[model samples]
Target: MKKKSTNNKKTAICGVLIALAMILSYLESLIPISFAVPGIKLGLANLVTIVALKKLGVKAATIISTGRIVLSGILFSNISVIIYSLAGAAFSIIVMVVVDRMRVFSVTGVSICGAIAHNAGQLLVAAFMLENVNVLYYMSVLGIAGAISGAFIGILASIIIKNITFSI
Candidate 1:
């Protein structure tokens, strides 16, 4: 049936997107783009996540994001990294979905919001784990970084979305 074929196609696309996200994660680790504040990077894997969210919907985006985090954690990082990533990804996806649904901003705006939320979530986890509220001080710095990086990812996502011809 056409429905079965469509589902198969969707599954295949999801798998490819997951792989792409993982590759981006690996590439990001190689970039050496660190900061004095710690835990600051370009969030390159998020490009795939934003594109997936726009193209495949929330469930697919969430799955791709989770798949990238788990796979990258297993191969390149540790449990602590996984925890921080999950929290960030969860917050990022939720905010992006809400913002995107509002239709008030472009993909770039959604990404900016998502990036800020991601940083906040990670900082929350870090504060809890370290048992130091002082870590919250990092928000101002991280938020600015998020806005900048999110804007970059959002622009890339916008370009990719525009070029794609398929539907989910």
Candidate 2:
């Protein structure tokens, strides 16, 4: 009974976090970052993924991450956005899970890996859609952006989960 309740509580928490991520994604779309960089955000939604990974585990984090991206795509963006987000979220979450199991790095490191994976995933999708190999050129910038943002968000998630005491 206790285990069941704990799982239920975790599920609820993940759900709420995913919803918040969706809202953040939409809001992010509304206010384009002033950065000269074409496509980047603070990656605020990434916070939820990081938290979910620590609190819920890899599988739960994957589910929530994918769901949030897909729902956000459907609600806020187009099929292109869907393709990009799905690819990135899927690849990044998988890398995160693998890194997490290796235990070679701290949670922050794992999160950064996820962020880098996200860019690779998105680049792959962009290349597929554009039908051009030149897409790789853009990756260097995205990777750098991902690394910085991912590390920041990952650390933030680690801190929040560590301090919350939410049984998550």
Candidate 3:
């Protein structure tokens, strides 16, 4: 019975977090960063992924992350966006889980790693799709942007994780 209760709670939390992530995705789309770099954005939805990873563990976090990517892609963007997002998300979550398990870095460090990985993943996909290595030229610029955005999201995640009183 206790196990069942925990499962229910987990399900509920995943639902809410997925919804929140999708909403963030939409909200982020509304805001234009207008950087010189073509693919730069603050990655606002990543805040939820960081929080979910810390609070709910990798499996739950994975569910939430993929759920948000698929739902947001279908609703707000196109197939191309979905493919890029899935690639980036896959790389991001993998790096986050590894960094987090190492216990050497705080959430900020993990976020930085995840953000960089996400950018790399996207660039790799772009290169493959375009059949040109030039897409990777954006990595250095995107890496810097990733670190900045990751730090911002990480700080927010830390605050949210610290302040939340209830367990998911």
Candidate 4:
């Protein structure tokens, strides 16, 4: 009974987190950044994922991250975008987890790494699926953009980590 209840609580929390991610993704999409690249944004949703990783561990974060990208893709983007989001989320989470294990960086730093990894992941997918290195032609610019976004999300994650006193 206790176990079941705990799981139910976790599911509820996860649902909220997923919703938060979707909202961020949607809002970010609505804003316009310079259109030098076809797809680029702040990755605000990643803030939640980073928090989840710290609070609930990698598995929960991964699940939430994957679900958010897939569902958001279904609602707002086409199949190609979905593929890119999935690829990016997968790669980003992997980097975030590895960095977490390293214990070398603060949450802010971790977020920065996560953002870069997200871009790298998506670019790799583009390279693999589309067979075009042109995807990377913009990576340097994207990296600079990613650093800014990552820092913003990371700061948010750090607050969530610092202020909220709870467990997964």
Question: What Cα-based lDDT does every candidate model obtain?
Answer: 0.90, 0.83, 0.90, 0.85
For model 2, how does the per-residue alpha-carbon lDDT over 1-168 read when each residue is reduced to its tens digit? 999998898778878888988887777778867465877777788888887777777777787888897787777679877877888888888898889889999878998899999889988888888899997998888888888888888888888888876653
Residue runs of model 2 more than 4 Å from their true location after superposition: 1-4
Residue ranges of candidate 3 with Cα displaced over 4 Å: none
Q: lDDT winner among the candidates?
A: 1
Candidate 1 segments whose C-alpha is farther than 4 A from its true place? none
Q: Judging by lDDT, tell me the better candidate of 1 and 2.
A: 1
Could you tell me the lDDT of residue 150 within candidate 1?
93
lDDT of predicted model 2: 0.83
Worst 10-residue stretch by lDDT in candidate 4?
33-42
Better of 2 and 4 by TM-score: 4
List TM-score per model, in order: 0.95, 0.88, 0.96, 0.91
Error of 4 at 47 (Å): 0.8
RMSD of 3: 1.1
Candidate 1: worst 10 consecutive residues by lDDT? 30-39
The lDDT ranking, best first, is 1, 3, 4, 2
* lDDT tens digits by residue: candidate 3, 1-119: 99999899999989998999888878887888858776588898899899889888899889999999898888878999999999999999999999999999999999999999999
